[model samples]
Target: MDLNVTLVLIGVDIPRSGLLRSGYPDPRTGQWVFSPAKTAKSFNPSAVTQTERRFDLVDLAPFDYDSAEGMTAFVQHLAGIEGRLRLLRARPGMLTEGEMPEYLFRRTHGIVGLLKRLIEDGCTEAMESGAEELTPELLSTIQINLGNLDDRDPTAGEIPEVPHNVPVPARKARKKDRNSVFDDRGGSVAGG
Candidate 1:
């Protein structure tokens, strides 16, 4: 629920060319003027597909940047993965109404796991790196600080299983055949 540190972030630029908009004809000039479009809201009801995507080392807290090449490579690699994930998630109607809750669960679960691993990795890396470069007093401080972090639980704890009272169909209704139209299975859809 509360995170003090931001491990990794991705920025995406949705090009204007990709946006879907509506237009209204002006009564006086007979010219079409742009208006807000419910493109995403109207389009999501008939889609069916769910996927789980994995991004390795999402926030590598314990990553050692001993050398410039290692740091640069790590940054570039993480950036690429983050960028791809952001784009995948940013698309409209990617998560159907039924899938929204599950998507949120997966995303939050993934982030918590990432944070846990990062802390563990950071502790190990810090100890090793500290042994090599840190002074006795500095090492003591590092040990005290990171040692306290070891006991903390990184999981999103105590999630009670709530039954879905609504009767959910085994399969979501699709507007078109899966083969006819592309599904959101780790790839971009045609109009989406």
Candidate 2:
């Protein structure tokens, strides 16, 4: 019998040690050791071989928080989806009206997870308080934690304040210097 298999490992910050190491094989066993702590006594024979290809994932760019269009669309989409806003009362143009978008962006800092939590909590609050619409006043009362600390303490690290009416500044263009090695005798090359 013959079998084929493919192993896939995914993570945000995968350590170079342990099974991921591409070190020299042990002289006695001729096997790669997977000890991350570098202790002589600790040895794991299940280390990954150097033949395996490693691909690093590029970090995703943050969402555009300066503009409310993206946040507004996300909220609208979330509400329109089935099983999402079933309990909340139907209100025409409820999410996209007035200061709701700005308020939401300010609270969530354009983070999708935070925004979702805020919306879900706001919906629950609306149902309980008989206020079907999501208002700035209603959302302000709903305290959102950073989710890094313990949930038991409601007064833990709150979401960082995002200033209103302040747009994200544009990134400055990087200046490129002419390669001195390839430069001509006429001072320096005009372009690369």
Candidate 3:
């Protein structure tokens, strides 16, 4: 906690502009903020679609860079991906701007999985970029935001307690050599 390792991070927003993009709307807030918003353009296979869209904010918080595979994927992306590679691309404004770009690519197309992967990628890149303080806090926030969609664990809300009186085993203390002093060495020639 005391070490001063400065880490740089970038926040990313996936482009939600294609017809195929799908996600749940913000349930409590009743907004399309976090969800993917696909443009409902008249069924046009003819028109070109911008693969990536911008997001709200990006944070480059201090963090510990962990995970090799994650860093690899991020490096690959930075090196350049096949299709539209949408991401925050790292800047101080990312944290303040509150928006990111999303890209539509043919491969790696599982919506939910891909999004999670992208976030993971962002964190990896951030760490590689020398961000020490921002990564953890930023990543934690991203998780908290996205965790909204996940169903809460049923056990988490419940209170825990000790069950019925299953008896605990007892340990015995060793008795001291109390009778040792009373025994005369049996050599009574001089003292007798």
Candidate 4:
């Protein structure tokens, strides 16, 4: 048998629209009919309405995963953030502006502008250096590291030779002009 003392100690917060066991008499039968007892109407509405609050925490749920793609994307995002932060927190000496022959006074103006331009120049230089280092071998190595350079794939085989004698489809070449409008059927659309 269930004990009543244990159940009584736990005060259950049941949402009651009216008093429990409350009833009304049937009009025709004169029998007592019961319904869920709703609490007496209050000055307040049923639901509490308030302004939406902002969640301060960063949502990293999408980046948190056991999958290789998710991990790679997360790592790439971190790397990008690191790069940007490094640039943002860079010292004036790190940029080429320090090498400039101009001497600054104690109350020099436009120093912030000079620093901004120097940072831009440094970013351009870094981009140029990265572009110069890009090669097919580096790309192949990256692909290999990512487990994408599979030799077993048919399309990944040696490049096929192109045939000199091939029939080209006879179709009118459409001109891509800013003022021109073309529809899906290759017909000129009537509009500005």
Candidate 5:
């Protein structure tokens, strides 16, 4: 007979390293879904259930933006935030967590720009902290999507090598003198 002991929570809030997971809206539907990284790692032990219902965080795969759009749209969104978090927190039925991604996503997708802003902010913090080495800790954690080709799957080889079509503006091969039809200079030319 399997005796089911009531699960007890003894401790909480144990911080550990983990991937800053990402999620995005479906192209067909606007619903938010986990990115490949998150979806892939969801099966891992760190994500499934902690020992005695506790988690030891881990980063299996790094989080990032969509396949086609890249991080540009994400950065644009972050940069667009005008420091009015109240509006963002108030949306999606006043649930900040559920709505934050959408709130961010609605504006833009420039991840690299957002990261640059974060680094700039961290630099400000570094300035205020008397140039302490520990100050960079905050800056170190930031994961910026710089749209690097390293993000691609190595097994896939090159990305099909898109042939760029450069349009060359055609210049007039010959310059012709202007002739006015009403000048009547060619009126007798038909006699030939």
Candidate 6:
């Protein structure tokens, strides 16, 4: 019996100190070179030897937290405001309207995960308090867990100014561009 197997590993902010144990400055090129016993004692050398290929994927573009339209769209999507069923029953002039988006940006420091939690908690609080809409006073009562990633101190910067009367552009809607080679005789898609 014969078998072909491939394994791929993906990680973020992986620490390289353990892999490159010790290095001395090269006398010829004045560059640091790993010593013969570079691998840490805990790391199995066989694993490194077995790794046929290593690829570092390019980082994706960061979210435009500064864009009022983008942030509003994100909040609306999370709250199901644009959908048939609403996750948060925000008052008419709140959330996607007025200064709520700016206020939320300040509170969450523009972090999407944190913003989601904040809105979810605010919704729960509103429901419990019998409030019709989310208010600054009501949301202030809800505590957000920042964890280790963000500082408890308020983010230092002026909130991005939102343009008035400017319509938020709709997301581009287009059919996926497919290769003509995949089309069958009946003009239907065939398995690649």
Candidate number with the higher TM-score (2 or 6): 2
Task: Please give, for residues 81-147, the per-residue lDDT of candidate 5 as tens digits.
Answer: 4233232122332212333333333222323344344445544555565552212234443333334
Each candidate's TM vs. the true structure? Answer: 0.17, 0.44, 0.18, 0.19, 0.19, 0.41
Best by lDDT: 2
Q: Roughly what TM-score does model 4 have, to 2 decimal places? A: 0.19
Off by over 4 Å in 5: 1-27, 31-63, 81-124, 130-138, 141-192
Q: What is the alpha-carbon lDDT for the whole of candidate 6?
A: 0.52
Candidate 4 lDDT tens digits, 55-138: 111111224335667545544543443345343334433211221212111111213323233334444454555642212222
lDDT of 6 at 124: 76
lDDT-better candidate, 2 vs 4: 2
- Give the candidate number with the greatest TM-score: 2
Better TM-score candidate (1, 3): 3
lDDT over C-alpha atoms for residue 2 of model 6:
25
Worst 10 residues of 6 by lDDT: 157-166
Q: lDDT, candidate 5, residue 90?
A: 23
Query: Model 3, 39-100: lDDT tens per residue?
Result: 56657543333322222223222121245654444434433431333343543433222122
- Order of quality (lDDT): 2, 6, 5, 3, 1, 4
Best of the two (2, 3) by lDDT: 2
Badly placed stretches (over 4 Å) of model 3 are 1-154, 157-161, 171-176
- What do the candidate models score in CA lDDT, each in turn? 0.34, 0.54, 0.36, 0.32, 0.36, 0.52
| Candidate 3 TM-score, C-alpha based | 0.18
Encode model 1's per-residue lDDT on 13-123: one tens digit a residue: 111222313334466765445444334554563221111011111222233345666545544543443344322123333222344323222322323333233334434
Query: Which 10 residues in a row give candidate 1 its minimum summed lDDT?
Result: 48-57
